[model samples]
Target: MTLAFDSAGLGPGFADPVFDSQSVFRSVLNAVAYPGAIERLAHRPGAPEGLDPAMASVVLTLCDLDTPIWSDAALSSEAVSTYLRFHCGAPLVAAAADARFGLIGDAAAMPRLDAFAMGDERYPDRSTTLVVTVPSLTEGPQRQWSGPGILRRRTVAVAGLPDWFWADWALNQGLYPLGVDVLFACGDAVMGLPRGITVKE
Candidate 1:
């Protein structure tokens, strides 16, 4: 519902916006820099019924007035839409490919990596960044990934994503600088899966 959600009505975002957002932003950067590494969110913000703290923290930190956002059915509730609009002031796009930021509360049923915007050759940085909410980041079958941030290889076990995700990921990674980047969140933890990282089944 609301933050503090208590009688006082603390509000619906980081208690301390500046400090909290910086912390979460740093965590996000670190997660992306070191693929497969799990980063726990220190700031737990109040969010809608279907949204979790990790996803909330991410949206509050990354999405802004200039970005276009898209969400799957699992996160397309009126409450969630209201929360995103109120907190981020970002426009909600109808198609995933039109969004600069995509939010998925149901990773199992989410669209393929190709469904989202893959920045064109010249402006590869314009690609969409997907915030995917999963069941757990510490439990499940592990996949080995190696890339820019990783020294050699790192193993990660993110539970709940469908098998097709990994398959689609291979193609995504193959696109290198042209594909979408992903942040896998569960509870208060987030794991990054940038475009450079290659995951071996």
Candidate 2:
């Protein structure tokens, strides 16, 4: 995808505002705690125009020199990669399993959840994190979510998800200690689906 950025409010600089960093970290913490619930954020830094704000926020907060990131074909822009490398100091990896974090620009084309690295029983936290960018968070087919962070099985919808996404997610969850955690980003809204969550079609 060709990304066009509007930096009118941000001034003329490639760097995302410092406030964006703080907001992203705080929001992600809440997401991990709440799981499967959507949280809205402001000041989507490091994103080009038309790109999801939450996606930019995540790339800024989670990626660093110690992490490896893999991007889907749509998000494989030279500008995007350069910005991430220059600001976050993260290394870009070619393989999904080798990456600590993966960015999926096209939700329809996302790989099966099982394709990525799943943490072992001894270290469940070692699994990879997937960041998926969708068209919108509010409109789509709904799914039932029940897990540690959920309250009595809540109903939610994530736009741009493929028909088999939930099925793949279920299979991944069955793997227990060996499954990747997924984060969905639409505009400035985000929702986390940890490895433990149960998603029903």
Candidate 3:
């Protein structure tokens, strides 16, 4: 499928009509390797208005026909959705529980973490992955984080989140392997929290 990115109404000065997604994938690995540290983001500017370069980069890197995606209501537009379908070949999902990748373009609109798919005991790796795009990446009101990816307990103050997610995240930690993972994107930077993360209030 050919994407008419030029006519998609993206802003001026966006070069490289099609972005190379492998770079972002590699960056994701680095981010996961060192939890609590922000990983630098890189993307071609001028992506469609609703779709940030960082979010788009992740979509490109991970999406395929096998991946079922659930887009946030904020970015559930025909143009953006169609572009993703054509470019990434990702199948849109009607139910969050059925989605392998849930794209939360607006952090505020994100559903409760428990509402998403947490893998079953038989296949703990089958859980959904949330891709949350926040307005800022800087450390906000710090919260403790510790797990496999972390060297020690780290503090992160994130923006654009409600009180309930932290509560849900805290609960999810007890579920062990039967929980969802998360990836946070801001600008071109990305970070991750696997189900293993033990968050402390």
Candidate 4:
């Protein structure tokens, strides 16, 4: 038997794979370390048609053959799956609970936060890291945030999230160290919201 490969809608990966991944990794690290602070990713991943540049960059930087990724319907195109498999070598999984990373292309229609892997009490690091695409990182209803990585409460505004997002987030936070971490991608900007963080309108 023979298998045919399709490259019709594939896009370019990192220009300098090693160096580019390192740079983006540092930016992501800072975002997670600073919580509410927005970090800019300088390199563009030349992602496929349906993927966001920032989201694509995160996948390229963090995922590998060992990571299982799950994507919402809007981002689950063949082009995207092929692009990620070729570039990041990450496997796409059907269930969010089995994914180490989850991508939400349409935040407004995103699934409930509890649907993802919340890890276990003995190994919280096993939880999923959700990368959600949003309209703008700086133009929405403001919310107050405080917790580890934050010295004091900070106000942040993010556009394109679902109406019950914050409420769901609060419930997720109640799970303590077992809940998933979130990364918001808006254009070239990215922000992190670790499990321990507190968010309020």
Alpha-carbon local distance difference test for all models = 0.89, 0.80, 0.78, 0.92
Q: Ten consecutive residues with minimal summed lDDT in candidate 1?
A: 2-11
Which residue pairs of candidate 1 clash?
none
lDDT of 1 by residue, 5-47 (tens): 2223223788999999999999999999898999998997998
Candidate 1 Cα errors over 4 Å, as ranges: 1-11
lDDT by residue (tens digit), candidate 4, 1-201: 998877776888889888988999999999999998999998878888879999999999999999999999999888888899998889999999999999999999999998999999899999999999999988999999999989889899988999999998999999997899999998898999999999988
RMSD of each: 3.9, 5.3, 3.3, 1.6
Candidate numbers, best TM-score first, in rank order: 4, 1, 3, 2
Per-residue error for 83 in candidate 4, Å, reads 0.5
lDDT of 2 at 130: 95
- Runs off by more than 4 Å, candidate 3: 1-19
Model 3 weakest lDDT span, ten residues long:
9-18
Listed in order, each prediction's TM-score against the native is 0.93, 0.87, 0.88, 0.96
Please name the candidate that would achieve the greatest TM-score relative to the true structure.
4
64: Cα error in model 4, Å: 0.8
**Residue pairs in clash, model 2:** 5-49
Model 3, total clashes = 2
Top lDDT prediction, candidate number: 4
Models ranked on lDDT: 4, 1, 2, 3
